[model samples]
Each structure stands twice: as structure tokens, then as C-alpha cells.
Target: MKVLTANRLTNGEAVWLAGDHSWAVTLQAAEVALDEATEEKLARAGTAALLKNEVVDVALIDVELDSGALRPVRLRERIRAAGPTNRRDLGKQAELQIAVAA
Candidate 1:
């Protein structure tokens, strides 16, 4: 599977593209693309968002269902989904179960 992701231009916060076509703050809310059509659609949306200056570093990442939850395939993506590592209280993105890759 895949998930669309980017950094919100305003705040540089990692965000996921939701099924409803909205940008979500957490990975759990991201829309998973299980097929090529959905992936293409997501890619278009990401491109539009980028052109509108809504986000940056748009990309699709590979992912898998881990214990019934979304898990990013790459270490960098895992870190992004988990939020900052320095502190647990600030900008922490809930539990790992709550939230990617293209």
C-alpha cells in the first residue's frame, strides 16, 4: 500500500492526505492507496497542493498494515509519523497504532 505525505508549508508539520481530500495532522487519518488508480489520484492531489503552496516535499511512501495499524516502510517516515524524538509530551503524535509510506 501507499500513503501521501508532505510538510505543511505554514508550519512545516508533517501531514498526511486524508480520504476526504483534506490534510490530516496524524498518519492514522491518511488515506491508503491500495491500487494504481488511487495512487495516481493521490499524486495529483499532492501536486495541486504543492502548486498552491499548501505543502512541500510531496511524496508517496510504501507502507504496510502492522498489527492492523499503518506502519511506514522507511525509518525516516516512521520517525515522521511518531513526531519529534527529543520529547514525548510536545508534538507527540499519539501512539504508533494511531498512524506511512507511498
Candidate 2:
């Protein structure tokens, strides 16, 4: 499967394209495309956001549903999904943990 990802222009936060055509901060909310044609269509739609400076580094990435959870297939994409590896208490992982704790 494929998913669209980008960094929010205002905060540089990693975001995924949701089913509603809105950007989501969590991968779980991402809209997954099962074929290359759908991937290309989503990528094309993302171009407008890029041109508007609403996001940057927009691209499609390979992923799979592992144990009912969506996961990036490559190392680079994994890092992007999890946030900076050097700091465990930072970024998306940390934010998610905090949310769960709450």
C-alpha cells in the first residue's frame, strides 16, 4: 500500500493525508492507496498544497498493515513516522505516548 506524507509548512511537523483530504498528524489516520494509480492521483492532489506552501516534502511512501497497524516499509520512512531517533522524548512518539497516558 501507499500513503502520502508531508511536513506542515507552519510547524514542519510530519503529517499524513487523511481520507477526508485533510492532513493528519498521526499515521493511523492516513488514507492508504492500494494501487499505483491511486498513489499517483493522491500525489497529484498534494501538489496544490505544495504550491500553496501549506506543506513541503510531499511524497508517496510504501507501507503495510502490520498487526492491524499501518507501518512504513523503509527505514527512512519509519524514522519520519516515529520522529527523530536520537531523542526518544521528542516528536511524534513522545507526543503519542503523552496522549495515551492522558
**The best candidate in terms of lDDT:** 2
* Whole-model lDDT, model 2: 0.91
Clashes of each: 7, 0
Residue lDDT tens for model 2, 3-95: 999999999999999989899999989999998888887898799889988899999999998999999999898888888899978888999
Query: Could you tell me how far off, in angstroms, the CA of residue 13 lies in candidate 1 after the best superposition?
Result: 0.2
- lDDT per residue (tens digit) for residues 1-41 in model 1: 99999999999989999999899988889999999999999
Task: Estimate the TM-score for candidate 2.
Answer: 0.92
Q: Which segments of model 1 are wrong by more than 4 Å? A: 94-102
Q: Find the 10 residues in a row with the least total lDDT in model 2.
A: 36-45
List pairs with backbone clashes in candidate 2: none
Question: Which residue segments of model 2 deviate by more than 4 Å?
Answer: none
